[model samples]
Structure formats: structure tokens, C-alpha cells
Target: MTAAILADALTQKVHQTEIDKELQALKEQAMVSGTEDSILVNKRQGAADLLGSLRLPHKRDEEWQFTDLSELKAIDFVAAGKVSLDVAAAENFYLPEAHQSRLVFINGFFTPELSNTNDLPSAITCQSWTNLAAHQREQLANYLGQKTDGNEVFSNLNTAGMTDSGVVWIPANIELKSPIHLLFLTVVDPTPIMVQPRLLVVVENNAQVTIAESYGAITTNCTDRPQQQPYFNNIVSEIYLGENAQVTHIRNQRDSGDSFHIATTAIAQGKQSRYQLIDVNLGAKLSRHNLQMAQRGEGTQTEFLALTTLAGRQVSDTHSTIALNHPHGVTNQLHKCIVDEYAQAVFSGKVLVPQAAQLTNAQQLNRNLVLSSKARINTKPELQITADNVKCSHGATISQLEADEVFYLRSRGLNDYDARHLLIDAFAGEILDQIPLASLQGRLRQCISCRTI
Candidate 1:
């Protein structure tokens, strides 16, 4: 079919009236909450208007070409009037019970009463995203949406709807001995509630800190509010790395079985700085993540790693972009997906090297394993290099276990299932090794092991 034909076909597609109404309400909320930050307000309001006019995925949207969200139009779920969380229910998702500091959120609202920070390092300061100083607002305003190109609709959607998300500051020259955990708990409701939790993290010059941003829905909903149901989660996180600063980040999203999630992350690395990301998406009806980075200074380095285990009819999509704009910057990205039953997974990795970014070193690889014929995987890895003095490469692979490898294991007295499980684990072991927390690492390993076995 020609382009004109495709356009005509999409124009004839139907959209759910409910999606239009929900979008209109979000726009009105944004207009009512006018901002002193003129740029932000304009972006938010304009984005809201754009989203309101969207077609809500007809057959022509190539980006959402693989999955259809027409069912999202039929749901009558409404967002709660006031979002809150029970303090007791908020304590269960912490890291191994061994983490020293934690900040909790229930249904996107910050729960200060339930947070514990006594275990924080003496030289460090940790506060709620709402409690940041006026001077800090500049950081959040400047870095929040500034991190990425907002390539997808969900990215712009997150930018327009979220206002209460927090800011994290690690002051200059401070090295922390403990990890800081930010926990988000979404309440289940009968009506669909769209929640976008935003984060702006700053690691000052020479500062060292590790952060764990964990997301999970309150699996058990109240019997009294059965009419209210669990909703969808859309989040965007942006990070800034100062010169010589080093940071480690872990983003784990394991929400309720029925909920949907979409996430995006953007990071900028400074000279001599190091940044790493570990993305583990284990839950959600349909989950997707977009990650990107810009090497704006010489000697900066970044590592991107993601591991996903999905079953049922669930699907996960990940797309990453890396740009090296200065000399001697380095980037390494690796991702793995394990699909079971009727699940599907997608991966896209792209690297850009500008002419000015000389002597850049970049590599990207995506690997996937499918456990059943009903499962499918799509992998695309590419590189765009303009610099003559650069070392850049990209690759991808998708397959099941090799019969010869399985035969060797069975001959050595191992069951076929055990042998297959071992190989899958080994494929993801590199990412699992980079996790610094011993307890979380072990838990993740066990989670993957059980599902694979």
C-alpha cells in the first residue's frame, strides 16, 4: 500500500471516547495548575493538547504497530479523587530488609511518615522530592524534560501529567556507604488511573552514591473499593552526572499482574564520570522502556544493562539511544529478554557519534531467549557514526537452546530443563553481576532461576 492509502486507512479507524475524556481532564488539570516556570507550563499545556488530539492507536501507528491498546478505550476505570497509601503496606518492598534508608510512596503520593533515614551516611543528605530547597528547583526544572528527545507518545504524556515527583541531590565530594531506596506503591482500582512518577537525580562533583528506585503496585486491593481497580503507570527519570562523580542506579518495576507500565530514562555524563543502569521489568500487562544518554564531556563513561522475564500474553519493548559528543567518551549497552508461553519482547539500540566526538568507543548488543513457540522476540541494534576516529559496533541475536549443548548436559546426568535453565541464566549473568546489593542480587537471580526452571 502507498503512504496515502495508509493515511486514509488510519483516518477511518475508531478511538475510544473514554480515552478522549481522560485526556481532556488531564489538560484541564494542567491549565489550572499554572506554573511560575513559563517554559514548563507551555510544554505541559502544549503536550496535553497534542495528546488530546492523538488517534489513540489506529492501525497506522508504526511505533505501536505490534500491539493494540483498543481495549484501554473500553475500561470505565476512573482515577481516584485523592491518592494515598497505608503506611504498613508501604514497608514490604524495601531491599532485603537490609537497606539502611528508604523513602516510600503510595499511589504516587509521598508517604513521609513511613520513611526511615537514620541509616544514611553522616555526610549525606536525603529528603523528599517535595522538600527540596528553592535553589534546587532550578535543577529539577532544567534537567527533568531536558534529558531526552521524548521520542514516543508516552514520554510526552509523562512530561505533561506528573507534578509531585521528587528530586534527589548528592552534594559535592560526599561518598556514601549505603544505598538510598525510593519506593513507589500504586493502589489498585476498578477504574483505570494513569500515574506518572518522575525523578531528577543530581550527583555533584566527586560525589558517590547509589540509588534504588523500585516500583510495585499494592497487590492486594481493598474489598470495600472493588469498583476502584488498579491502573496504569507511566514514569520518566532523568539523571545528571557531574565531573568526576560516580553513581550506580537500579530501576526495578514489578507491579500487579493486570497493570500496564511505560518508562523512559535519560542521562548526561560529565568528564571523568561513570554511570550505570540496571533495568529489571518483571510485571505489567504491557511494559516498555526508553533509555538514552549524552556524553557531553571528555573521559565520561556509561554502561546500560537490562534484564526482563515475561510470561502470559505480556509484552515488553525497550529502545536505547547513545550519543557521544566529545572526545574519548565510552559507552557499553547490553540487554537480555526471556519470554515464556505466549509472551513477546522487543529491543532497539542505537548509537550516535558526532563529527566532533573523536576517539569514541561504543558497543551495543541485544540477546534474547524464547521458551515456547507461542513466544516471539524482535531485536534491532544500529550505529550512526560521524567521527572518523571512533570504534563503534552493534549486534543482536534471538534463538532457543542448542540441541548439541543440551545433549552434552543430559549426557552428564543433567535433565534437559536444568541444562536449558543454566544457559539462560548464563546469558543474563553479566548484568546480574553488576548489581552491588548482595541481597537484591540474590533475589533477582532466584526470581529468574525459578521462572526459567
Candidate 2:
């Protein structure tokens, strides 16, 4: 390789030494602060140990072949402690639909005053992990901090840094009339910091609930130059659904343009359970989502839908995996991305149907639209089926806007910008229309209409 190439490689190399030093500093700070309970302290220590032995994932990893963490490596991250919330500052981020059941967290710390759960039914319990009783903590020990062992450097790092989490439990045979919303707000911090927000949900047999999770930043005082604070949000969510349970999960990531976000959602479903997830990504300098789901029981149905819109120098990557472990399982997944300016989008969807997953039906599709000559998209769909009786298919497509359609709209007395916006709205409506909450749907549509740099 040439000298320039060698220099680039050096810069791209994983900064494991610096990352370890930061981790050690955080551990020392945790010990000195001594603000957390033994349960959480032990969990963080275990996760820190695991992360100490590993390095952040890079483009060399098979699952991360399209995404790079050079920007993340360049940052010197510190722990984000609790910050005083200006009630007026957080009002703009609340959702009216979930006004009665919303949970608010600032910089990954739960704020009870901003959260409303008083009108919720007695059967439904929503509380923060740090407030749980001793017995409750003991009950969740087996589930917390337990994930697929190695190669998950970010997940481990998140666990090590996790201080508190949100927990929701629904009893059997109950259905929530309205959706539960979680609002994670990142305020301006003088020092660059990282926050890990954890969520755990458990639904008993024959229960049903809807959850909407959103992320945003607090703006400064200047209206003319609304600047966003730089921060990193590493979030993890674990969901468990019992037999005949149903769940609708909608997550939106709209952070600051100067921020970084990495999130993972792990789900386990029981027999005859139904689950659907609608994921939307619109902000952040670099954002990635890892979705892993397993159908552990027979006759399960799962659906995953995602939409990514990027402009300027933004980058978005989504990697998802679905495993069918039992017979009579069905899955349908569709992911779409719209890129403009100098942005880039990446999608990787994989479905696995093992020998035991006979009579499985799976379909996966990835589609991308590039609105600018400088924009780029990389999409791939993988299907591995060993069951002879399974029906599985996967495909991908990348295309630019149709010139004839643009011309038709232009002839209808609409300007170029208007025509383009109309077409993009229609393109994104397919996924936006599926959002069950009208308030959330409208909010997302409005966000999609605005152009961000």
C-alpha cells in the first residue's frame, strides 16, 4: 500500500488502548462516587470486565462490513451524570397521545416529575430499575446483563456503564387502551459524555401493549442559530412476550446532527405470540441499530419495518437478524432508506430457518432511493434455510427518483422542490401509515417533511 493508504489505516485502527484507559477511569469514578446499589454495581463491574477483554466492532467484522467507527474512536468519552432538567425545556418533546402514560429520562436518568403513570391500571406496573425492591432485583438477576457471549463490544460497554433502567410489566389477560411512550432527552453538557438507557418489558399470557420510544436533544437559547449539544446515547431494550401475547413497538431516533447513537433490541417470543416493530431514523452524525429476535415457540408471527432518511454528511446503518427455532413460524421484514446530499445509508437483513423450523414462511426486502448524485446506498438481504418444507425469499433494490414522475408533477403546476417533497412523502407513507398512534404518525411525518443538515 502507498504511504497515504498506510496513514489512513493507522487512523482507522480501533483505539483499544485509549478506550480501555477511559473504561478504567469510569470504573474508578464509580467506586469513588458509591451512589449505586450493590445489584447495579455488580452488573456494571461484570460488563466492564467483559468489555475490557474486547474491542469495539469495526468494518472488518462480518456484521459491520459497511459501517466504520472512526468518528467514535476519535472522541474521549466520559460518563454522563444526572443533570437538572428545566421543565420548560422538556415540554416540546412530550407526546399528547401518551400524556397519561409517558416516562421521561434526561441524560439516561429517570425524572419522575416529568413522567405520568398515576392513571395507569393497577395491573400495569411501570417503574425504574433503581427503585425496585430487593426481591424484585433478585427476580431480574437472571435476565439482566445476560446476552450472547462475545463479539458484542458495544452491548458490553453499555452494560458496564448502565446506572438505571426502565421496567414495564403487564399481567395476564389485560390490554392497554393507549400506548406507553418513553422520551429520552439529552441535555447540553460542557464535557463530551456517553449515556446508556436500558429498558426491560415483560408481558404475561394473553396480554397486549403498545410502546413508542423516542430520542431528541435540548436546544440552546438562540432561536436563530439553534445549536445542538454533542453526546453519545447507547441504548438497549429487552422484551419478553408470553404465549398468545401481542406487542407493537415503535422507536424513533432523532438526535442532534453532532451526536452519535448505537442501539440494540433483543426480543424473545413465546408460542402464538404476535410482534411488530416500526423503526425510524432521521438524525445523528452516525447511527446504528442492531435488532435480534428469536421465535422460541411454534405458531409465532413477527414483522419488522424500518425507514431511514439521511441528508448532509449523516450516515445510518441497520443490521437485523431473525431466527426461527420452532415449526410453523412466519416472518415478514421490509426496510427502506432515502438519502440526499452527501449522506449514506446501509441495510443488512438476515433470516435463519433451521432444520427444526419446518413449515416456516419468511420474506425479506430492502429498498433504497438516492435523491442526489453524491449520495450512496448499500443494501443486502440474506436468507439461510435448511428446512426443506420452508418457503423463504429475499431481495434488494437501489434506484434514483423517476424522471417521468417528477416531470408529471412539475406539469401539474408544482415547483421542483414541492414535487420532490410530495414524492418523498408518498415513498415514506407506506411505513408511516402503519404507525398505530395518530399523534406519533403526525409527528414523524412532520419530521420527514423538514430537511435537516
Give the alpha-carbon lDDT of every model.
0.72, 0.81
Q: What are the TM-scores, per candidate, against the unseen true structure? A: 0.84, 0.90
Off by over 4 Å in 1: 1-43, 46-59, 73-77, 80-88, 96-98, 121-125, 221-230
The count of backbone overlaps in candidate 1 is 11
Q: Summarize candidate 1's per-residue lDDT along 1-453 as a digit string, tens digits.
A: 112211222243323343344445545664575423444455565555554455445437655666656555444433333466665676556775435588776766667786777887654546654465556665556665777554456666666555456667788998877788888778776656666677778888999888988888775642111223547677788889999999899888777767767777889888999998988878777777878788868998888889998887778888788888889988888898989899889887888888988998998889888889999887778898889999988898888878898899889999988888778878778788888888778877876776665
RMSD of each: 6.1, 5.2
Candidate 2 residue lDDT tens string, 50-143: 6656666778988788788877776666667678887788877777778889889998999998999875797687888877777777777766
What is the alpha-carbon lDDT of model 2 when measured against the actual structure? Answer: 0.81
Could you say which candidate leads in lDDT?
Answer: 2
Residue 377 in candidate 1 has what lDDT?
88
**What is model 1's C-alpha RMSD?**
6.1
